[model samples]
Target: MRQTWRWFGPADLASIDDVVQAGAEGIVTALHHIPNGTVWSPKEIAKRQQLVRVRKDGSPSGIEWDVIESLPVSEDIKKQKGAWRELIANYKESLRNVAAAGLEMVCYNFMPVLDWTRTDLRWGLPNGGSCMRFDINDFAAFEIHILKRPGALEAFTPAVVEEAARRFAALDDAGQKQLARNVTMGLPGSTESMTLEDVRAHLAEYGNISADRLRQHFIDFLSEIVPVAEEVGVRLGCHPDDPPFPLLGLPRIMSTASDYQAILDAVDSPANGMTLCSGSLGARPDNDLPAMMRQFGPKVHFLHLRNVKRDSDAISGSFFEAEHLGGDTDMVALIAAILTEEARRKREGRADWEIPMRPDHGQDILDDLTRRAQPGYPTIGRLKGLAELRGIMTALGHREFGLQ
Candidate 1:
């Protein structure tokens, strides 16, 4: 595996120097300054490449941009309405530009409205550390009271609904506002700034959309974009839905192993692949992480290796971020499965045998608490995760006979 780190642009709290000091070999980032549904010009791509490679004093940073965390698929593309064709053309042109710039892998998601959601960004852990969490009742409170979306009550059980009502009754005005902000903060520049009116209008547009309709839209999206990806020799990976469940009356199509297999089989191309985020998929207890990796390893183009400790046995139970090797998923077996895939690719003489991976999220501990970094992306925390994952990769490579 080639180690990588996700970096927001120049204004990010975690600097490029921090990435280098942490021992990452590659960068996983996007052109976030550009608007969604716009084409990425080669000039813009080159400018980002220069930023990643060159230091402030014109010295070398000694790392290259390896994978695009996303080239976003627009809302118009997801619903297949309102100038979707133009957005599709723009997406294809972006892929062409990415390839022309010598980058090969791109990651994107098909989740509607929100990129991800969590009720609490500062869930306190027992060890006095802090991590992100998704408490079911807290989310229900947001739906029933904060956003006040119609038909939201029908999605949960009677017990959950009653609990949500109680929770919502306890919140003061400031608490209610903070909860709304936390849920909408998933996409950095996109929905993070949406007002209550903006959120209500956004959910109303999807009233007529169902799981079947949204899925077909995703297939229609792939049928058009995957061909261009194959032609340009770029690999496109679809990230799974975070929390792996339906929320805010929205349909979730990529929450399970079956969901992924269905999409891969529908498109039937190497360019159509999976991002293989362990933390997101692990949110569902039914998803056997190692087994899924073994079955779908050939189609996985990129990796986000983190862990989550679920609060209950139920698939939709609350969960909080865990240490790299401390969560419900089997880190040892998962790494072994990935090595098996890499060995097979090497035997077939494939160029991209070593899949790029990053330590996805980490718990806030030590100096991280005071740094006040991005919610899940503290400097010291991720360094700890990368160190643990690197140790596992090294041990696995040395123990396996054919692994290098």
Candidate 2:
């Protein structure tokens, strides 16, 4: 795996120096300063790439921008009815520009309304850092009690609805405001912004579109672009739906193995692939991470590795970010599967098989707390995660290949 870090460009609190110190040789970033639906000019892409590659000794080692975390799909694109042709065409042009600038992997998601959802941004960990997590109850409270969109109550049980009402009632005005922001505020890479009205409007766009409809929309979008991606030598990896389920009455299409298989079958191109996020799929017990890795290894172009602890009894279980080797998903088996795939690629002489992997969703710890880092993207916690994963991969390599 080629290790990389997600940097939010120059304005990010985590500077390029910080990324180098964290031990990644590659950068995963987007042209965030550019608005959605606009083409990222090759000049802007080169500027960002130059900034990321400058070494501490002031030499340019060409630390490349290997992936675009996302090129946001405009609201019109999602609806597939209004101004979508223009947005899709612009998106393809952006892909060409990025490829022209020498980046290959482009990661994006097609979730209808929201991206990743976290009920708490500061879930305390035993090891002194705080991790972001989702609480089912908190999400329910947001949907049923706060956002209060029509038919939101149908998504939860009666008990959950009652509990959500109680939780909503307990919040004073400030607390309620914070909860709204925490739930609705678009995280990095997601383009959707939410006021209560905006959330309603977004959901309404998906009104008649069932899960299959949304999936078709994604397939249509990809069908138009994957050929272009292949022509430009840019691999487009679609990130799975976080939490792996429907929320707020919106249909979630890319939350399971079958969903991914459907996507690959629809596009049937090597450029169309999966991002394979462990934290997203790990939330569902039925999603065997190791098995999925084996099945999708050939098509996975990127990886976001983090783990979650799910509880059957608790609707809102506490999830503290664990060391890479400490999570419920067997890190050993997962890495072994990835390594096996890499070995296969090597044997086949495929140059692009070493997928770019990053430690996703790190805890906010140490000096990171003092500085204003993006939520779940604190530097030290990710450094710890990267260090741990590196050690595990090393040990696994030795055990599997008889290296010292």
Candidate 3:
């Protein structure tokens, strides 16, 4: 595994120099300033490449953009409506531009309406730290009272719905508004922000889109884009749905191993690959992270290595971000499996044997608590995570494979 760090452009609180000081050899980023369905021009790609490589004072950071954390998939393409066809064409052209710039991997997600959801951006932990959390009751409160989405009551279990009512009633106007903002916040610095009305309208658009239908749309998307990715020698990785389950009565098609396997079979190309987000998949108890990695080893193009502490045995129950080695995932076993896959790729003479992985999310600890970094992305927290993961990789490399 090649250790990488996610940088949200120059506006990111974590600077490129900060990434270097954290010991990351590669940077994962995207051209977020560009609107969705628009082309990422070669000039813009080069500009970003220069930004990643050169620091503010014209000194080399000695790091290049290794992989695009995402090349945003437009809502039009996900719905297969409006200007979806044109968006797909634009996506293909963006792939060409990225590949032409020498970037080989691009990660994107197909989750509709929201990219990821959390009820609390600063949920407290036992150790006096804070992390992002998804409380089912709070989420239900949002669904029932805040957004007031139809059929919200029937979506959750009886206990959850009842608890949600209590929680909703306890909140004042300010509390309710905060919860709504937390639920609706899209990726930081993107144009996907939504109002209550916007969310309802989006839900209305998906009224006829079932899981099967959405899955087909994803397949149609891959069928059109994967070949172009292959031609450009770029790999396209589909990030798993966060929380990996249905939310607000919307369909979740890419949340399970079987779902990913179906996707692998759909386009059946090297360019069509999995992002293998351990945190997202690990939220579900049924998802065995090590086994999934071993099975999907060949198709994994990138990795988001984070861990989550689920509140219950239920797959869609609440979960909070845990320390790198402290969550439900067995980080050692997963890293070993990744090493094994890399060895296999090397033996087969694959040029892209090293998978680019970044420490996905971390709890706000120490200075991070006051720094007010991006919600899930705190400087000291992620640096700690990256160091721990690197230690594990180093130990496993020497112990399991005897590679120094």
Candidate 4:
């Protein structure tokens, strides 16, 4: 596996120098400054390439941009409404531009409204580190009280609804505001500045859109673009729905193995692959991470190797990011599964045998807390995770030589 890092461009707290020092061999970033539904000009792409290849002192950084973390699937494209056709054209052009610049493995998601949601950004741990968390009761409270979306109560179970009501009743205005801020923070990465009204409006639009309808829109998107991906020699990987569940009564189409199966069946091309995110998929107890890897390994073009500890056995419950090997998912088994896939690809003479992986979100520890880093991305924490994963891969690689 090729270890990589996700950098949010120049404004990111984690600098390009940090990536090099952390031992990441590649950069996973995008033209975040570029607005959605616009073509990425080759000039802009080249500028980013140059920035990634050199340090501020003009010395080599020993890494270049490898994968585009995303190329933003616009809301227009997701709903197949408004100027969707124009946006899709822009996307195709962007695809061509990136491929022409010698980059492959583009990642995107089809989640409507919010690409991801979390109720708490700085949940305290017993170890004194802070990590992001999604408590089900708090989330339900947001739906029933903060955003106050129509029909929000019916979306959750009766027990959850009751718990949400109790939780909402306990909060004063200040707590309520903080809860709202945490949920809406997902807007930044989704690239939309939506107020509560804007969120209401977006939810209303999807109110009439069913799960099947949203899924067809996703498939409709791939049918048009996957051919272009194949022609451009780039693999387009759709990231799974974060948390892997429905939120705000919005339809979630990419939450399970079956969802991915349908997607692969619809497009049925090597270019149409999965960005296997273990954290998101592992949030659900039903999703066997290693099994899914073995099943979809051939079509998985990207990897987000992180772990989470769910509070309950239920699919839609609270969970938090855990240490790389300390979560519900078995890190050893998962890495071994990933190696099996690489071995198979090597035997088949596939050029993309070594998959690109990045240590996903990490807890805030030591200087990480004072660094004011991106919510889920912290320097020391993620480096710790990468080190652990690297250790596992190394041991697994040398197992035949008695290293195991």
Instruction: List TM-score per model, in order.
Output: 0.97, 0.95, 0.98, 0.97
CA lDDT of every candidate:
0.89, 0.82, 0.91, 0.89
Candidate 3 on 1-404: residue-level lDDT in tens? Answer: 99999888988888888888888999999888887789999999999899999776789999999999789888888888898999999999999999999999999999999988888999998999999999999999999988888898899999999999999999999999999999999875564688999889888888857899999999999999999999999998999998799987989999999999999998899999999999999999999999999999999999999999999999779999999999999999999999989989999999999999999989999999999988999999999999999998989888556532
On TM-score, the candidate that comes out on top is 3
> For residues 1-404, could you state the per-residue lDDT of candidate 4 as single tens digits?
99999988888888888899999999998888888888999999999999899887889998989999788898878888789999999999999999999999898889898877889999999999999999999999998888888788888889999999999999999999899888877533334555788788777666678899999999999999999999999998889998899888877899899999999999899999999999999999999999999999999999999999999999888999899899999988898999989988988999999999999989999999899788888989999999999999998989683322
Q: Residue 175 in candidate 3 has what lDDT?
A: 98
Name the 10 consecutive residues with the lowest summed lDDT in model 2: 312-321
Report how far residue 64 has shifted in candidate 1, in Å: 0.4
Best candidate according to lDDT: 3
Looking at candidate 3, the ten consecutive residues that score lowest on lDDT are 395-404
Tens digits of lDDT, candidate 1, 139-225: 989988888888888988888899999999999999998898888885643322567787777677777688989999999999999
Candidate 4 C-alpha error for residue 245, in Å: 1.1
Candidate 4 residue spans exceeding 4 A from truth: 187-191, 399-404
Score residue 289 of candidate 4 by CA lDDT: 92
TM-score of 3: 0.98
The runs of at least 3 residues in candidate 2 whose Cα sits more than 4 Å from the true structure, single-residue gaps closed, are 55-58, 189-192, 313-321, 399-404
